[model samples]
Target: MSFSDAIKICFQKYMDFNGRAKRPEFWWFALFCVVVSLVLGMASSALSTLFSLATLLPSLAVGARRLHDTNRSGWLQLLWIIPLIGWIIMIVFLAQQGSSEDNQYGSTPAN
Candidate 1:
């Protein structure tokens, strides 16, 4: 998916955590978040903070969907707090190709 489309979908499903998300969708939105945060941070800390708060749920929801695409549980995101090893594991999982076939999460995310 393109960047704008990914952002749109993520916001639309900000409170949703039940489906799968393709690589492009997840990565593009992640990029958007980082870029926007950087720009906003440079402009004003308050705006950046507000933006982060606004995007937090969408980020989590999209992340959950990304994990679901890999046929893993969203709860696994908790591993992010465990420092280097955990972060590395999550990065590997998120970067790897998602399952092509359906599993417990749902059908494969559409490209």
Candidate 2:
């Protein structure tokens, strides 16, 4: 998906976590979040914090859907709670190619 499309879908589905999310959808939105956060942070910490807070739900939802695309459960997001290793592991899981065929999570996410 294109960057703007990904961002739109992510925000539209802000709290919807019961589906799949293609790599582009998740990654593009992630890039949006980071870029916006950095820009806002440079302007003002409060703006950055508010922006982060506003996007938190969508971030988690998209992340959950991304994991679902890989045939994993959303609860696995808890892995982020651990230290460096968990972060690395979660990154590996999220960055890896999603399941080619549908499994327990549902059909493969559309690009």
lDDT of 1 at 13: 98
Each prediction's TM-score versus the true structure: 0.96, 0.97
Per-residue lDDT of 1-111 in model 2, one digit per residue for the tens?
899999999999998989799899999999999999999999999999999999999999999999998889999999999999999999998998999998787888776
lDDT of 1 at 50: 100
The parts of candidate 2 lying over 4 Å away from their true place are none
Residue pairs with backbone atoms closer than 3 Å in model 2 (clashes) = none
lDDT of each: 0.93, 0.94
Model 1 stretches with alpha carbons more than 4 Å out: none
* lDDT (10s digit) by residue, model 1, range 6-105: 9899999999999899999899999999999999999999999999999999999999999999989999999899999999999998997999998898
Q: For model 1, what is the alpha-carbon lDDT of residue 63?
A: 94
